[model samples]
Target: MKKYKLLWLCTVLVCLTLVFVGYRAKAQTFNSDLPFLIHTAESLNGKVTEWTLFTRETVHLASNKSWNQKTKSLHKQFPNMAWTYVKNRDSKTYTGISRKNNYVETIKLLSTNVNGKSYSFLIYEVSGKHWNDHKVENLNKMVSSQLDKLYDKKPVIFSCIQGHFSDKIDNVLLYEKNRLLKSLQAKKVEALEENDFYSVSAYSSKLSQELSTKKKEEMNVQIGLRKSGLGANTNFVIGTPIITIEY
Candidate 1:
């Protein structure tokens, strides 16, 4: 009996030590590198979810080397997340999928030349089901906190909309470099010339339809879509608005 008791006690201590070591290792792995901010949003159908994190510094590494390093790190941190690797001529991609909730994370490294200089750009994105909003929010917060270590200044643009067509003219609030430029109300006639940022009177389910040939030829613009109606399932009908923000 005494011998059995001693063996059991020794086994318990070893198990506790291993658990503590693993916890510390996980903590260390997630502590060093993190994203600046995580953008989380749900799809129109709410069937799919998306999270994107942009890093301040661009990654400069050989295509193969970068792919291998990222794959190793992601696999280590998310041991349960199965990973698939693919290599193309100018880009390497690694995608990880969580077994628990079918969450997916993709890391891509693309080789490009800027001003005759070769560069590697890294993009990290994740998507999953929108069933648990709190879980998604918490995950983003934790990931961003880790990425805050590599925080650097970068310009970002954002916009918001207000007012209903029936009550008043719909207004768009635009921000650039974290400063509000102006609030634009829906106009009777869309401007022929493009400004730094502008809103158009166009409404379309397809983003490509909003831009005109002249506008595309003259200026560079990024487009965003905002949909409002009876609900996400409501089809195109009366009072349905699909606002496009071109910046």
Candidate 2:
């Protein structure tokens, strides 16, 4: 009886482990908006050259000592990073950059004092040019983990990707607008800006992040395409909510 009971317990434990793993795998599949961006780029036959994720929060600090403590804490958290500081008349900023073989991560802490009250704005960003689908999962995990630790409440995140196609196509803006709307299941809210070379602003249900304007409409998922002035390549930018980096 004891031998059979031991075997049954082992089997149950194995089954439970498998179930947990399966659940985590499923959760990871639709966790972030990066995969959708990657898919759209692939569909357009573009090679992704750069991508970025950024989030920021503002919090009340007690004093300059608190600011220093926060910076020291970040230094310990990311020991490999070197930090630089800049000060102006009203505020001081600390910028730290960590460069790996493929990706670069930046953290900025801006502090200001107003009428004896101190405030700090914390910003975190990560960018890379070379990554595959599996590596993207790691990037998402890294961003989520750090943001969770840094802020008690969730911060709004912006994701941007840049890529290029070897061959230039005519009417690239209209081509991308239609393709992305189909790929993202999104509708055009309004063209924030459009020209012969670029298109921006749209909305999609597939994305979890969105922004609401006074117009009573939500805007998320922005796309921009511009032709290379000298080459036969076309460059594109895809961002969720909005693109913060310069195109």
lDDT scores of the candidates, listed in order: 0.32, 0.71
State every prediction's TM-score relative to the real structure. 0.37, 0.77
Residue-level lDDT for 103 in candidate 1: 47
Off by over 4 Å in 1: 1-57, 62-70, 99-103, 112-118, 128-133, 145-247
At residue 67, what lDDT does model 2 achieve?
A: 80
lDDT of 1 by residue, 1-247 (tens): 3543343344334323322232111132221111111111111111122222222135656555665775676577657656676666544456655534534444444556567666665444444433344464566565455344222322111111221112111332122111111111122223221222233332222211122232222111222222233232211110102211111
Residue range 1-247, candidate 2, lDDT tens digits: 3543343344334323322232111122225677788787888677888888887777676777888898888888777788999999878998889898778999999887789666788998888878667676777777888877677766667788888776655666577668768888888876543344555567787887676644656777677666655556777778876666655
lDDT of 2: 0.71
Q: Relative to the unseen true structure, what is the C-alpha lDDT of residue 6 in candidate 2, on a scale of 0 to 100?
A: 48
* TM-score, candidate number 1: 0.37
Best by TM-score: 2
